[model samples]
Structures are given as C-alpha cells and as structure tokens.
Target: MLRVADIFGRFPQLETEQLILRKMRKDDARDLYEYASDPDVSRHTLWNAHRSLLDSQRFLEAVIEQYKSKEVTNWGIEHKADRKFIGTCGFVYWNPDHRRAEIGYALSKSYWNQGIMSEAAHAVMQFGFKKMLLNRLEARCNVENIGSERVMQKIGMTYEGTIREQLLIRGKFEDVKLYSILRSEVSLEC
Candidate 1:
C-alpha cells in the first residue's frame, strides 16, 4: 500500500545557491525526455533509453508513485540562473541497517561539464547526513565513467574500490568503481 503522505515525506525540496532540487511532477514529462530518453545519458546507467514519450510518462508516474510510497527520494534538478529543468538526481536505495545509501544521478548532455552534478551532490549529502541521519553515502560509477568519478571527487568522497564484473547491465557484466563519503569525513561547509 502507498500513501501520498509517505511519498511526500520521502523527498524534501532542497535549495543550493545555484539550483533547486525538488520532487518530480506529472508535467515534467518534457523535462524527463531531455535526459531519460537520451542514449548518451542512459548508456552507462543500468536502464536503457526510454522508448517513447508514453514510456517516460509511465516511468514518471511510477516514480511519482514511489515518491508517495517512500520507496525512493527522486529530485528534479533546476538551475536557478536559467530557471530551467536540466535533469534528475537523488538518493536511490536507502539501507538503514548499513547506515548508508546509494546515490544516483543523470544530467542532460547540455548540463555536463558545468559542475551541476557536484553542486547537487553536496546538497543531497547534507540531506543524508543531517536530516536522514545517515552515516555513509556511496556512488558507484561504471569503470569508464570518469566524469561521474570526478563528481564524487568534487564532492569530497573517497574512492573505495572497483568491484570487478559486479553489475549485469544490458546483459554484460560491467566493472564498477565505488566511492564513499562518510558523515565523519564531511566538511561542515558541505
């Protein structure tokens, strides 16, 4: 059973000096299509390119439902300077017993190399450590995803290790490089 209250409780609106990180909406289908449907953005991720606008709509509906279910905390990233929706980023899987969670994100190609992900990550980490009381946060990137690895470094996370053939993405095992930032390691300015 899913409750709207629970879903609303999962994702809280967050603001950084340059961006607005907030919950997704039904009307965000156009924004969703920008990155979620792009092959370049989805290539490294586990999921494949969205097949159609209808598919993106369906996916957004399910994500919104999950928001209501408290199953995931997903955010729509918006740049304040431009007041435009650029992409999505948020905590994916939360593991309370382990005091950690997996962080995932995808940015439209237009936003790449602009330090947007790093800024969003800092805001998300603050939410995890302070509001969620999480002790650890992890970001696992495909071995070849140097740009993603750079975001982890920009956020002050430490390289954990590479897990060989850890994920079966698109039917082939792929190596994943894990990075983590602990509450103890986080700077107050973060």
Candidate 2:
C-alpha cells in the first residue's frame, strides 16, 4: 500500500515514444487553453470548456499547489514532436487500503484517433501497477464517449457495466461506463 505522498512527493515524469507525461506548469497555460477551450474536447468531461486562457491558468495553479501539498494531480501530456501540452492523464482518486485507483484523461481533439492517448494511458497503467503497487486500476467515462471507451479498451481494461446518473456534469446528470484491470490482468505490450 502506498500513500499519496509516496507517489506525488516528486511529481513523476513518464515518457513514451510520442509523449512526455510530466507536471503541468504555469507556462503550459497557452497550450492547455488550446485544447481545453474546445467544446468538442470537453463535451464528455465533467468540466465545461475553458472560456479563456485564465481558466487554463487557474487550473494549472491548483495543480501546482496540489504538487506542493503532495496531493493527487494530473500529468500534463506533452506531444514530443510538437512539444506542446496537449492534454492530461492521471489518477482521479486513490484508496491505498484497497490498493485501487481511478484514472481519468482528456485530450485535444486535433490529436484524436491517433493512438496518442492510448499510448499515454498504457504508460500510466504500467506506473500504477509497477510503482504505485495498485491491485486494480479503474476508469470511467460518460456513456456517450466512444473515444474514451476505446482508449480504455486499447489499454486492456475490461468493461464493468454502466452506472446510471453517476455524475453531475455541467448541471445535468450523466451516466458513465466503468472499466477496470487488475495488475494480474495487465499485458506489458498494451
């Protein structure tokens, strides 16, 4: 069992062939705003599309504080080729006693369907199992989000069924599909 501090003490930086999963910084505001402001990108997410760069900046400020406080926070997804912050991926919550955690992510629409998110998520799952010592890693997405569901499947998570009105997103309750994979079920090649 690991504590949040044990994992977030020094924000971990993960890398893949096409991405650098690192801490979100104040300087990433512009890049974050680029994608976060897109209605299409945020349509299925809990948060509304960012209205301005300030919205992105405010979000990063909170993430920075979370890092300082040794709390849970997201890894900024930086596309290696463009060196731009394209999205975020990380644990939404962790229950060490159960060795379980829920993962979440959001990506720029421009890079959708490119397998970039699947690659990034696979790395995060590997970290959860290998470093975080998680027995089970889970994720949920709005029922209508086929893209997110595909990412979960690509990373080898099994569909676990839908929860009706699981979340109140932007004033309306939305159903979500749950998915999970145990450490024992993971394939490194994923």
Best by lDDT: 2
Least accurate 10 contiguous residues by lDDT in model 2: 181-190
Instruction: Estimate every model's Cα lDDT from 0 to 1.
Output: 0.84, 0.93
lDDT for each residue of candidate 1 in 77-98, tens digit (9 for 90 to 100): 9888887777888888876666
Best by TM-score: 2
Off by over 4 Å in 1: 1-10
Give the Å shift of residue 63 in candidate 1: 1.1
User: How many backbone clashes can be found in candidate 2?
Assistant: 0
Residue 79 error for model 1, in Å? 1.8
RMSD to the hidden true structure, all candidates: 3.1, 1.4
Measured with C-alpha atoms, the lDDT of residue 92 in candidate 2 is 94
Candidate 1 weakest lDDT stretch, 10 residues: 1-10
